[model samples]
Target chain A: MRDSRGMRAFFQVGGIVFALALTTVVLVASKAPPFAAYLNIALGAFGSWEVFSNVLVSWVPLLLATSGLLLTFTVGLWNIGIEGQITFGAIFATWAMRSLQGGGTDPAFVIMLSILAGALGGILWAMLAGALKTFGGVNEIFGGLGLNFVATAVNLWLIFGPWKRPGIASMSGTVPFDKALWLPTLTAQSRLSPSSIAIAVAGIVLVYVLISGTHFGLRLKAVGRNPRAAYLLGIPTWQYMMTSFAICGAFAGLAGAIQVTAVYHRLIPSISSGYGYLGMMVAMLVNYRAALAAPVALFFAALNVGSIQLPIVLKLDSSLAGVLQGTLVLFVLLAQGAREFFARKGGKR
Target chain B: MRKINRFILVLFLAAVSTVAFGQSSNFTFGLLMVGPYNDHGWSQANYDATQYVVAKTPGTQMIYLDKVNPADRPGTTASQLAESLVAKGAKLVIFSSDDMSDEAVKFAQAHPDIFVIMSSGDQVWKDGKNAKNIPNMVNIMGRMEYGKMIAGVAAAITTQTGQIAYLGPLANDETRRLASSVYLGAKYAWTKYLNRDISKLKFKVTWIGYWFNIPGVTSDPTQVADDFFNSGYDVVVSGIDTTEAVTEAVKYAAQGKRVWAIPYDYVDAIKEGNAVSLGVPYFNWGPAYVSAIKSAMTGKWTSHFEWNGPDWKNINNPDTSAVGFNRGSVLSKPAAAGVDKFIAELSKGLNLWKGPIVLQDGTTYLKDGVAATDQQIWYLPQLLQGIEGQSVSK
Candidate 1:
């Protein structure tokens, strides 16, 4: 029944809630009319349907990246290069959109092909890191780090060199694609793109099934737990590791593609938008459990969406949201570590 | 005692009524900033200007949302943030920066009652490709090209290496025009006054592909500046928002490498670079902001693009005009005199636009003696000839 794990989860949730509540109270009490700013934040994020849709806009990428990171975490890998994979995915998607923009090609067909290209791009980057680790015996963390730099360089090169807007390029990023080529939105005025959200939702479910319901998932866990033993059992540890990376990359890349197609509609320098890194945090916060990643990501996204009220209502820095997030995560980790220490002590006694 | 108590109640009720009237008539002014308010650069200029206007105008309240980074990041979208300000009863909204163009357009269309002003943007200009300007939207920019030219002249006058470098941020029409103007000024002073062949002057520009060093996405401007000094380029002119040129110049100078720089935007940025800082052509956003605010308040607002230059009488004057260059402490007496003469000619209406201007791609942009229009200047498509940089050619 994993009763101990359940108890740990319970305490973790309790700790986060307490930390957040205390922080809000302190911050608000420090300011005049404590609940007003908090109220604004709540109303800002969930006050209306449109506001909630904005939260969903932030959700798709975080969920996609975190879900992918869970797969790698299951296989005992920290896929830190997810940012680069995301960038490459966007680059490929942008390339596809740029090429097929003017011709009489149906936008739907082009979008389909572009999404595939994005997945391929991500898969390629992920496999490169995997090959470096499996074949060359390099640590994945450092390898991923190096690849991240290379990917940024490549993104910059394209931005300034081949893909530069005619006459000028600014941080505003590439000129948006034609209205026809843009990913169609669900409603006319809202920023929420339905296709991307649908893909992300389906992605989380598929990942859950893949990890919990399949033999491949079991073998992946086995390899991660003890690669040497897994190899002795004829599970082909190298293949499993490579496949896990490939799957993770596919998801991260999909996140990048959605970010490009749905949100910005152009490859800005911030196309990765730190979601890959944030996803790492989200995964860790959920204790690498895939089921909890969505809720955690939603909470962070809401924190981000809601924090806008800080500057408008209270003249406070919007980064207070980031402070709340950091505090919550820190307290949660402390609670877990303390629980672990007592559990170990109790067993010895 | 009864009479005194009745008088106090009457006074209290009068005060309460006035407060109610004031609340109903309060003009809430909103400013949307893409960076920190006190950045001492681009965003600071707008913030200070907004404060200046609020102080001058009666019954006006001020609120701002800073670090509204982008759609992908957490926090808020520009449109939604603007909406929040409007919810707070903002009557007029100013979306600052080139990056906020799309947001400005969306907001202008969505909220017609709120007067919209987009600073350093050209999306409202008619001649631009895909011209879309709403009746309520107005675009304003400083004639900073003149300042860039002055900065270029300062660099040309200071360079001992005969090689000048421009540390540019992002590639855009605004950046291209600024960089090109600097190149033109440097080339002119070199050939006309310095008695050096314009061909002999080596001017090369390196772009960091963003307005600031965004770590992973953009090359560090400090490293880029260090490379310029390391490679024998003696004068570095900053074309980005950050003070990396002057700060890096100061760092290089501390290391005993002789270098000079000109920082853009804020007038006080010279303090950051000190010994290495030449003159800065600064923006005085106060005059424009105050005027625009008053216009909105008076119901006399109309949509029109305004690009201003410094008032020669007092370049640092806070109130009316003075939107241009303030010579820094580094200029030698003779160099300062030369810069003054340049400014004098500029004030009397110097026309760089009437040009035998050839673009970097070797296409003629302006026929000889034909002055370029405001729309033409707003939409420059490439770095001009004689400027060594990446040509953003179609």
Candidate 2:
């Protein structure tokens, strides 16, 4: 067991080294100073208090999405429709705020109710994907993918149609909410909201405790390992899967809610900002371990916030961040596969 | 002891160099473009204007990040990106798109010390509808109405089928007014220049819902241009920021369709359409940008709105004009002469926006013989009576 543990650490470190080497090659091919580029990303992310705050602002949504994805991954389900779930959450949050604003309700209470509505919206959308997978024999991957397109279409329709700004039909999105409806931030100018960070941290801790320290978590692991055996063992398989989906959806909805109430303060067309997809990557990179989710998601968010400097300082495309992220995930998965392959060979011998 | 002494010496030298270099008088301005810098349209015009500033002004440099829209730069806002530019030592930041109006206002409010120029926005105009008293923000826009009018005259003279199409961007006060300006120019050219019957002229507008194409969101501009040319409209005047109309017209003309296109927003746009091009009505942002940057540098930055018009003395003068029109190669000899004559009339104070104009909903926009005020033209509420399009966003 000790040897195997050592081997796992060796392989993980090896994966990281390989990813770095490959990224270096890419930088060299592009004729950029690799060290300078890396330095720029680091500085862009943590160079100053203002940019670091921006990283935290990005981290809340990403961490929330990853925490939710962890639940789905634990149940052996791919919630690819998390993007749609996030979009629907923002849409519902926008709807709640629009419906309740200036209607004589306390703004704080309206914000709370809107966030709850966002969670409900995500729950409904996720349940649709879960139901499609369970009842209609459709795969969750395809169902979720189809739902993402529908969600985007719905978002575009609202932005350009009924909810459009008066006398304007552009993709600039709905009019911003009143300042009174905004989530209180660390500063008047900063988008970082303490309440949002608290919510995200609470969400991940809840997910961690639920996934690691409960009988329900064991049953979820069993369902994930083998649904048929779990079913025979009297664990309600489809119900567990649907419950996991609902839990993940709630987390995603909260992320969307924070985005509306704190970050953008309005529903733009790209409100989801691809956090659902990025969260999936973070979950995969951490092997779905909830403990590592926060740090890894923060790292990814740093990469995103940092890469903006590539264009401004280095004249390089910011998509290099995506390239690094893709290679890191790819190398780690390859290392895992290699480890498993070698272990199987040893057992046969 | 020796190593510590050397480290202290190095640190002292670094501090001295930092202070020395910081004392040099250098002005760094930042630009945030809504589209690709090389798009050869609205964004490119602004990018070139900054380049001009860098060239003409001593001790000045520019740093810019193009494609600053949310779709392109995911997980970021325009104001947040402006802060990044500020981190790079930019004292003044230019938000170079109408779409960035909200974020520009936010950035200006947040950074009261940083001078901000929000191009094509009326937020700083005290008399404008959405006016805000942003003390550090200035609004600058070219009067593209006259350029569009020239494009209309070019289309009116070149169209053999008597039907013209206006490829519109989005429905707003700005777009409505610009589209209406085109119709007014076309009507004048059709009746006065060609001596044609008023009943024979047909001007229609088809808005693609955006300034440029976003697949699955906006209607395909190429398809819209094809629809116009495939039908009987011989000339398609583009109001969007890209050159799809000119490209499509070139495609149609290559197949012996005899279609022509008048592209907007870029001076060299006719080079794309070649013989099928009717001309381009482009904005020249250099003169205004240079002055704005100079003001910011000299601590003379005062917040105001400027709706700059073309230099009538030399409309296409790169250093002086805010707007100009370049005639294309496809225009016939007489048609080219007519465009020149129309320009001369405009230079001699002929007002196309004068008198007797009716709204699409049959309300009088301007009474008989009454010229429009700047506010009336800027805040035009609907398309004119003779134009065919939705005047308001539904």
Candidate 1, residue B128: the lDDT equals: 57
lDDT by residue (A1-349, candidate 2, tens digit) is 2239888888888888898899989988999767667777888899788899999999999999999999999999999999999989999999999999999999999999989888988888999999999999889999999998898889888988889887776678899999999998998878888999999999999999999999998899999999999999999999999999999999888888888888888898888889999999999999999999999999999999998888887778888999899999999989988888888888777
The per-model lDDT (C-alpha) reads: 0.80, 0.89
List A-chain TM-scores for all predictions.
0.94, 0.98
Worst 10 residues of 2 chain A by lDDT: A1-10
Instruction: Find the candidate with the highest lDDT and give its number.
Output: 2
**Model 1 spans > 4 angstroms off:** A1-40, B1-25, B70-77, B128-130, B191-200, B255-258, B356-370
Q: Which residue pairs in model 1 clash with each other? A: A168-B171, A168-B172, A169-B171, A169-B172, B310-B323, B311-B322
Per-model B-chain TM-score = 0.90, 0.93
lDDT of 1 at B181: 86
